[model samples]
Target: MFSRLFDALQGGSGVGAAVRRRQVDAEVPNFAEADDVRAAFFSSALQHAKSSYDAERDGYVWGRTLRPSYALQLHPLNTVQTYTQKKEFVWVGLTAGPWFVGVVVLQFNYFAAFSVSLYNVESEESWRATSRVPLPGPWLGGQWVPNEKGEFGPTSAGHRVEFSAPLSTHRARLCFAGRSVQVDATGVVAQQLPNGKSAGAQRYEVHAVATLPEEFLGVVFPLGPRRAALVSKVAAAPLQSPLKLRLGGTEWSGDGYLSMDYTRGLLRRETRWHWASATAPAGYGFHLSEGAYDVDNKSVENTFYAGGRAVLLETRVEFHKVTAAAKVWTLTGDGIQLRFRHADAHDAALHVGVVKTDLYHAWGTFDGSIRVEGAMYKFDRVAGVLEDHYALW
Candidate 1:
């Protein structure tokens, strides 16, 4: 039954063939709008109608097909118009000097939410602000805009994002303003996957750097899926960016790591997961994730990127909490083992009648080893994040 469902979700045809056929003489869209550029960059002809887990391969075969486009055109499997129950989001984070800044834009059926956070590595200080607004209809409408770049988020909502291109090297801008906090920043993709096509089981990813010129309070903050019931799609990229920031009228600059995350999908009533990633010296980066959405650990999102290539790992990862406060945790897998001690943390709880969410994100260091493709890489102290999230809707 699952195989049949997976086949159906892949359009019941050779996905590569179908995708190739659709690409014949297809010219990339020419648009001036940033949103339109993103839409074209992510757009795909495949429809994700169901979720499938491949036990033999220990991977989750995405129901959505990947093609050469600027935007993703994702459709829900069911006809129900419960927009609020559906979720889509784009999150970006960057580290500058002794500070880390993050931006998130989330859209549901009836409303949109935005968040901006800043963390100080030396003082272990963290601050976050969030807001939400009502959305009357589907966020982008359900149609593709030809020769134009679609827009994401409204200025009135206190957050907005724009992209320069869909594939290869690109640039993006994130702007936010609310109360005493205001930020405007730009991210330039220095390197990315050769093209916008999937390589075997790996998703598209990029490396970027962001810049912010102004200061907010004591910090110059610049930063930055599909599914059925519980369907999810995620793209993870490691970034090497240098940034200049101002805090309390003081200027600072340093090299830092950055990451971009985009997700869209229908969700189950309950969900939980453990996810972690980090960038190290010598162009080495790693990503690890495990949980309910991982489909029995078969669809592991674990990979190591080195020397401009990515190596996907087949392993089991476990997360052990050393304390209830979650200030310390242990992560172990077939070829990886690491310990994390939280340096800074953020927690949020939201309840809107039938829907509820709890999130904990910790920034810290990992001390251990990661074996990629039989080569063991060691880390004495590598800065990164550990996140635990749960939702009930």
Candidate 2:
């Protein structure tokens, strides 16, 4: 199937074929005049066409397609420094009925990592495994944006971890300490039409393809004059196919939400951030963060997904300090207030020569509400995860 898609992208004249497009001029739009949060945020004149990659301007886009309309090439502003600072990763987090599942494949120019974690919500039984191996060369790891059909992984040989994200399905397999974890998640695409034409083509033609699952956030922020990073996030609806999570010889399955993180490009040497993701049944979810990417008039990533549609929450978030004895952490911002109760955590501290990392992925329940456009959406004790991350590479 992928072979045919690749062949079509290579020469086919269909919608899958890559088209040559120009970048949008970097002009800030009047977000105040926009109708909805999604429209206001996406109204930024700094947009990127599906087939465009601009080193001078940063932008974001989202689509209902399982993969991107065009393959993202490795284009570095500081070409000579690409080998040292470039990074790529594909992370998927799911909330099955009584389980929390995660699969991540990450590759820095220096090393690559594959991690799989599973938590039984009711039993409080948790297991996680992380494998980090030094990269022999810059091009040694797997590709995040391989072809038109799209595939991402840190498929370093002998790692015992495998993951694939294609147009139709997402599957992952991991083995550690003689125990194993597997995930199979699938979702139905919301077919959209504009003027009786395929939304993909129409969006490509107008450079408006960066829209959503109905909601998404993508941005390219400058790390330095010569360095920048592209971070795209999506908090999507529950999958059509029941989420299947297998761990310790038992299988757990149910409808759940999915959130993805796709980050690439040169980033800061030292970075820290407080991130949170939570989802309620019936397609209510949000992705919020407070560091790494600056929140200003033109750049922000905080978003709410209501009814499978993305709405912008362009306010700075404050993450309260988390201590060993901390049970509930408060997160607040304009029109947003939530509490995250700690359940269990996967913590790790890695100090390899000059590279250092202190990471914590905590899973629990989120109880609170957020006000959007004068309407309050509230949830109680919905499954969620909070992350405290500091890295130097």
Estimate, for each residue in 308-347, the C-alpha lDDT of model 2 and write its tens digit: 5677787888889545666678999998889988766667
List the global CA lDDT of all models: 0.45, 0.53
lDDT per residue for candidate 1 within 109-176, as digits (tens), equals 45555555555656655544444454434432121111122211211123344333223122334442
Query: Which is the leading candidate under TM-score?
Result: 2
Taking all chains together, each candidate's TM-score versus the true structure is 0.59, 0.68
Q: What is the Å distance of residue 5 in model 2 from its true position?
A: 22
Candidate 1 whole-model C-alpha lDDT, 0 to 1: 0.45
How much RMSD separates candidate 2 from the native structure? 13.9
